[model samples]
Target: MTAGLLPAPEDRSADQGVRVSRSHHAARKVEVTSPKGTRTWSASALTDHGLPSAARRAYEGAAEAMAATDPSCQLPWTLLAGVGRVESDHGRYGGSVLGENGVSHPLIIGVALNGAGPVAAIRDTDNGRLDRDTVWDRAVGPMQFIPSTWAGAARDGDGDGVESPNDIDDAALAAAAYLCSGSGSVLSESAMSAAIYRYNASDEYVALVMAMEEGYRTGVFIMPVSVTAEPSPDRAGNKGRPGRGHQNDGRKPGSGATSSTKPHGTPGGKPNQDDPSGPPPSGGGGNDDGGTPTPEPKPPKKPPKKPPAPATEKKVGTLAPCGATWCLDGWTLDLGGEATLAKAAAHDYNHNEVAGETNQQELDGLSGAKVSVVVSFGTATVLEIEGLPYP
Candidate 1:
């Protein structure tokens, strides 16, 4: 749904009104922008809390690496932990465990995304190499990365000489990088919501993840004296600091997968079983460490202002292919670049009839046909088709 459309029904465990309570000591509030308005987030000091030994190390290591490479991102370990908890319970989903080497013991895989039911239909991109399904794709590992996305964002977090999505170290780093993409930093509330939305493409999912993340930040736990210490000389020297010098762990896992169907690392349909209705036990919901005392997060710098957008314009284009859920929901026009037909226009088209057929039916049949579009803010509510079955 766009800005003004009725909100999609909340998913299991993802109430549209979900909010993380902030009673815990040392909590800090950060405003987050969502489709439902502004929501406050409480972030707190670093704590080992309830995280597993290997998993905690990987989370911290990934944050530290990102800090070194992209300091502006201010990527938090807690954020990565939130995704892990929601996606696969920190590699413990389905009785699987994060082994000493940081790889999932039994491997956590989701159902095939065959475009069946509420699931998005995505043709197999990896040919049974990563998800073990040649016909369709499935979310895999603690972070649940899809094969195509993993191919681009995969990292060697543990410096183990191989990059596998099943490894928490690699998965966590890849997820951090994925969330940190685009122009703005994730520290801002709007940017944070945008980043998470890019991950799952659902407002409910964003609220749920933020709530769980806030839980970890404020929950009672042993606070580390220093959460942002400079990388230790030993750690800085070895890219495998978290791996404990284990280069060849002998774990050669397949490429990872995602539960959802959107391309470019969007995992839409994966069920978050960590806490169906609430936050997990403290640190379990989030994990990342800082060696120095955790300092207060600085406010994000505002971007330079821009002029207001123009009212409207007309362009010629063909319809974009209906591959993902977003495409199926609205009309996508390919006028050199993909643009969506406004929801209001879509509703009108669906109701009108053309040659005894509903406009939606006709529009679907006319996919890829040339047409002229009247657009504003990259969305159009008016169209002039070159060819139509009816006048």
Candidate 2:
């Protein structure tokens, strides 16, 4: 039973749309690439996030710590995975990778926070130590921890004792600790959302993360797509950010994870006590401390996994319309899972906003073009779209 999305939006909850309960499969020793480096994970669920083994392992550790720290909180691994995906694409940013030692060789640093516009403004907390700015601090590592917050919350996640921010294992622990600090339980949807809002300073950001997390958890990636009159040159990748039906919106993704609005030394960001959407108006998703150029270091490792053999790539949909042709603009749709073009979203990212048909009547002609599709074991919801020009 497939159905299109409602134009007005119903629950406004992130858990809407296709849901994949869980995968019951044996663990495979697969290696994946991240900003830190290629590492192996013994767990099957962790690898489904399209993340390298190292990142998944770090996230597993983080979720474990959070659960242990607060049994009532029971934080899920996908929340942190969502954060990692949004913040730095599983630490694969800047062409870096997680080393076997847990260090993000070459380092993962964000732009300087100049206090102008959306970026937060905080002076240097550490003098040329963690981020090496000595002036203003930059969010560091896979989880993007600000120096000010990292100073007090940084833990030896790998048990190496040095408490290095470059280590993904260590960073995961610190991030989990911060998420659980506000005395809030991430168990409930509302409470979990509130916790995510504290991490970044925007409601949109939280939604994007939660959406991605759901996909990772269920192994069903949702790719939101739009059909346009004119050709879109920016097809291979998004203009500013990554993923579907979402954009940066001039606000940093995780700026408020540990903003100044909260009492100093606390891991939690400026919690939106009132909105559960983002940081305080004056704070939250602002810039980092300041701007200073930091040259990243590269390392030798097996590059990220390549697409599987063409023979392995599966395709859905009947050629029944006989010669119907389809054009796709987003990332390559991986047809490795039990997927099919099942329903039309009735809307997608249009004019930079979610635009769609209001009723079935409005979508009259689209039925002929609608092709139920799905891709298993990959990321993306709305990938390949088939249509015919107006008659």
Candidate 3:
């Protein structure tokens, strides 16, 4: 496993119920090899599968490439689909669309790896090249490869000549290579767990990915019904996805406490010092030291209030001329026009956040390009606009 490639776990507690869901799936196995040992799959399998078309293709292509190059690895496309589903929901996360070329538009960049809460801190390695932030490195693309790891393991799976983390084909291939770097076939449950654990050192993440992989391998993949669905009692506090942070109060998966500042509690162990959970601590809080004391059950505490919504948000989409000023949907940029947009911050064609008058002059030409703009107080301002045909 690479040092800085440990991305934050994602929030997928809602889908934990698949373990006990309806088991009848017609028992169909996805084909992965032909008589010649080359990878192959039916078009109906790809079309009817839950994964998006581009993402499925990328996963299968990566598996095929790995099968030909490293025959001993035995990489399956379903494992990649499981990772992609948990990582970025097959590149449909945050309303981002996966292009025909396996590139996710607006880019599925994970939260900053600034060591905040349960997240691992990784200082800027690519200088805001892959992820837009220079202060901290983030997981990029459908497979969510960190900048440093992507720099080392990037591969041009789509034959695009350029190796980009934003491209799902490259990211999936890179992920397959990383998984196969170690010995053992990932088709086996134990080997698959070990391989996934290397990807993100969390047991819950491995379990979730395995569950998803099993479902995909069979035809009974049960996705989350809704975002509001709660985690099962067994998975309770261990709510997280593949390549992002936990949705719990900044807690790592399987940990009993809200924060990792203190000792983490295990099953039947002492409660954490930060947030005491499970049973009462030893002899205190109703469990008397002596006698069969009749301890009254305490009422459940009220759930914590959710944080207020942010006043401003970054809106990502295509931008076009709305009368005089540039607009995306109903929102219009406060800039006078392409000429007045010079002062706003922007990123060059390579997605690198640039500065100075030279970069500012290039902003005038982005009339109909895809962009990310900060919308606040009913006024939209360009933050980091993608330049030209998109990298």
Candidate 4:
């Protein structure tokens, strides 16, 4: 497995469990895991991370509106959290670097501090001084709204005259609006999921959003359902054939009734014991006709049995760098030679020991290097070269 790429264990607490404040409705805690330990916070952490108060308010307001739009909209809110985490680390912006020309840019910085440089800054409009757009142009606000798309979707969700991308509330509201768009409804599992994918096009984004939404619903979200009745097949056919009655008796012999039996009061009623045409019923003993009892059905013949599944080899021990380990069922190998030999031993069934000794000798002769070897219950071979130059 690659280092630092594995997901953190889910049981860890978030950010030392520090709880941040939020609006009454927005007051929910989030747990995050970090090297320092797990820490917990509220929506207020967005502000502490350098998001302006106005932006935070906008995000909260948008969430409320989305909750009202559809309970499923919460799915988008969870996605919003992940978007914010990845794009701007919860709204801590302005960490860009400058290019050789001495202007800041929006490119990603290296892990080491000494290796970092200033990124180019962006211009909001056509000012023409170096001509770059504002850093916000790259990705701005709580969910990192890109300027080109934000311009069309951004609204005065809080009724402010100027709509700024850096504002959390504005960004969140824009995200919700984009997700609730026509195609979004069909795309999302719920209204919220649609909005999340609209914010960022990735399955990871969807998973993160779903996780956060699960947290939110447990706190204060509620969903409602609606129902409608559709026309039945009979009703639909009746619409096409205007005068068709429920019972159509106009038909030739063998078409309408034939030899089929009907219940006592049906249109073509039969003369069964329940009908008036039969003899008067005897007192609870049997039918007045005195019929004999029918015998039970015979059992069905059994089918042939199927064969059992093949058995698998049991692993007794592992082959290591020093030498092979002993096992009743198989053999092992040391790491001085090719990995292919070990792989072959693990899989091969006929050899009952290492089977690639000859192949390893031949490989060593050709490459002028030592070949690796592995012996086991099987005869599969794996090969690799040692002391080779880099390409």
- RMSD, every candidate, angstroms: 20.5, 26.9, 18.8, 28.1
Ranking by lDDT: 3, 1, 2, 4
In terms of TM-score, how similar is model 4 to the real structure? 0.31
Model 2 TM-score, 2 decimals: 0.47
TM-scores of all candidate predictions against the true structure: 0.47, 0.47, 0.49, 0.31
> Which segments of model 2 are wrong by more than 4 Å?
1-49, 223-391
Error of 1 at 62 (Å): 0.9
Give the per-residue lDDT digits (tens) of candidate 4, residues 53-77: 3433545677677666433424244
- Model 2 residue 28 lDDT? 20
Q: 265, model 1: CA deviation in Å?
A: 9.0
Q: Of models 1 and 3, which has the larger lDDT?
A: 3
Model 3's number of clashes is 6
Clashing pairs in 3: 8-244, 9-244, 9-245, 10-240, 10-241, 10-244
| Tens-place lDDT digits, model 1, residues 3-52 | 11111112212222333222233332222222212222222312222456
Candidate 1 deviant stretches above 4 angstroms = 1-49, 220-391
> Model 2, range 1-391, lDDT digits (tens) per residue?
0001101112212333334322222222112211111222222322233466777788898788666645555778877777776565566665666676766667877655544334466678888577778776677877778777666556778776577667888877766765664444676655555666555544434444665676667766432111001113453334343222121212234321211121211112222211112111332333466544343333333322221212111122212221122222112333222222223344431112334433222223333332323222222333322321111
For every model shown, the clashing-pair count is: 14, 29, 6, 42
Task: List ranges where model 3 is wrong by over 4 Å.
Answer: 1-49, 222-391
Report lDDT (Cα) of residue 343, candidate 3: 53
